[model samples]
Target: MANATRSGNYPPLKNTEHDHAIGPLRTVELHPERRRNTRRFGICGRIAAYLMSIALAAALLPTPIGSETAHANGACRTDDHGIRLTADATGESPHFTSIQFLSASTGRAAGNGFMLGTSDAGCRWQPIYRGKLTFAQMDFVTNSLGYVLAGTSPEGPAMLLRTANGGSSYSPVPNGGNRFARIDFRTATEGFGFTFNDSGAHYTANGGAKWSKLPTPPNTRGLRFFTLEDGWAVTLAPGGYLVKRTTDGGRTWTTRLKASSAVGVGGAVYGAGGRDVWVLLYGGSGMSQTSYSLFHTKDGGASWKQVVSNATAGGGPAPGPAVKAGKLPGPAGRPADMATPDSRAAYLLAGSGAMDKLSLGRTMNGGKTWRNGAAAPGFEGKLTFPAAKSGWLAVTSLTSPAVYATRDGGATWSKTFAIPAD
Candidate 1:
């Protein structure tokens, strides 16, 4: 459990080496862009997971100008990450994917069908439930109580919703035909649901209505569970991609690490417990040489290292003081979005890089050391911090829907509304 420690990558100094008048490179890197279920890896793997979720949601869309989004006139200075995060409230269909926050006041944002919320730290936002369901999974352990999982299609009637006052209203847990691609609940009724491509991950003690089948390890994408027995999952095999753990709820499992320098893996996997886990692995040499890094695990997730890196697979982990792969822009400088509330304060987002701007990185004392934060625009999704100053950043592209807030942990951010229309 101690055989990883390599680090190298600090590159970022092109485009005429800055000074194009003074500022224009906010840790640029954007373009780099999940899970599981039941026991039916059948019907041709559910028609190849419904054509791989329409090419994996178009390969997880969002590559507009620099990747999450870009477009600013400019104003707020002091290292203007691009002066983003705006809204009196407007949306034709800007779009949002998923966002969750049970504290730092409260939170919710779901994609497509629209769901909205906030409670103070975010200034003031309302509207709780609106329908047709386009959510991909929303969670809450407090702030009223919550759980959502609508937006389904892969041959079956899927829907799982429940709200105890927060979302204002919701009721649908007849999740019997379970088409779960992702779901989690350590309480609020003790729950868990998963799928990497077709139905086969379950364990529900009532809150989710009903479910059973559990034992899974093959290709499971991001099955979470922080307590009620502990949990974690991530696998791809065939030459590297594993990461597993289970304390009892999932029956039995262990593996904890094996990225093999990864080529892809993104959706959701971050932690502040169980030895403090975190995951973000992506690599590319085609489509214009992309890159990404940031892996860590204390002892519960077996073994891992590479606290952060850029391209060329960068040396092996834990070496520090490195950067260069276009000199940190994002979209390839990869740090799409991340937030850790413990193990020593954390938050990272470099979305819309390549020049559109938006870079915010902070680490109180965890990832060695980092600073430069405060920027906004969109593209970053789900970055929550329930305390330690309080945080929340959930944005979607096409014009950057909205939902941002930070009391101090993330330097600064505001918005906290807009995202309802279409």
Candidate 2:
């Protein structure tokens, strides 16, 4: 993709000298007409030039995945037991990026400033809390306790909100300077939060009451804590990202393997035990295109084998003769490239492009084979599996995005009508 320009309109860096300056100072001064010409042609022209460069980049880069290749065949088919979904309460907009079910009867959904809850198997919904914060990720150790992490902008601080009485109320936690991207709880009393900061992992042993920082290896971007003692951290490197395992809690970690890397690692990391772990990789090779891959570690990242590659499954019709595979592109700019595979079962949501079109895939006996699920109407933002047989999908359509649920895997789906179109 084209490189975003480093222009004055962008937010200033926090530690830079310009951040300390009291009053506005001219970096460059020009006459009125000259300034007009510069504004019209300088930044705007540069942006347009960048777009052209990206188009060229896409043309030069190898096709990450054969666009024409059909979905892999021979994978186990999910039973057709249609799921029955009761229209639970909806939020300000039907666009929900995160959903968690503390149990079969209690759950919460979040997007934008709204958080909604259900108590009767999604039969009815109620507004729990509405604030200015836009939650990007959340996790629940139990129905009564959970945490939500919000993305930070210049207008406000990145927030860590906690609720002790289920979804009845929420209060902000004192996280100091860290901005968390992912949070996981091993138990109601022990939890961990991973941040984009280079410092390390921010952990809490006494629930969310107190937190301590741990030094993370360089280039670490994502983390998954299965239990207080058993967890994994994924770090980006030259070729792919590395997986580190911790058995004695987060006190120390051991390197497993530098799993296959692409532009960047997207989606959630799930571990069945100390022996099994899975991750999703996304983005293109510095080109403005898209590709998706999944990795599996049977012995805790000591070694990894690609369960799915750019190769089309089922040996189906070639997508116009495979374009020669070239070096994978660098990171393409986008969030929600991949969704966490289902913890109870190995399933993931992978999407590409501005449209965010999603494909659902599942691995039954580990990542040995993958079966394609039903096609989503639009971009699939998050996949929440309250039970192994029952799953919920949050997606964005052209007109009105909605949350859908499947009781029998992805065979059939039902929408929650209570969700608003905001």
Candidate closest to the true structure, highest TM-score: 2
| Candidate 1 TM-score, true structure as reference | 0.29
lDDT tens per residue, model 2, 73-182 = 62311211122222223333334667776545456676665566655444444555454555576676666666777642323445676655553335666564667766
Q: What TM-score, computed on C-alpha atoms, does each candidate reach?
A: 0.29, 0.64
| Model 1 ranges off by over 4 Å | 1-126, 129-168, 174-210, 216-254, 257-303, 306-369, 372-411, 415-422
Candidate 1 lDDT by residue in tens digits, 1-422: 22443222212222323111001112211111111321245566556544543442232222333222222442221221222222212323436667876665546666655556544334434344444456666876665666777643323344677765555445667555756776768678877777554225677887765677777666675566666467677666664456677888678878766665444343246776577777655544332233555566666654455455546433222112244443432222335667777876767675543333456666665555455544676535657676766777776655545667777777778775654433
> Candidate 2 overall Cα lDDT vs. reference?
0.51
Deviation in Å, model 2, residue 377 alpha carbon: 2.1
What is the model-wide C-alpha lDDT for candidate 1?
0.54
Q: Distance from true position, residue 111, model 2, in Å? A: 1.8
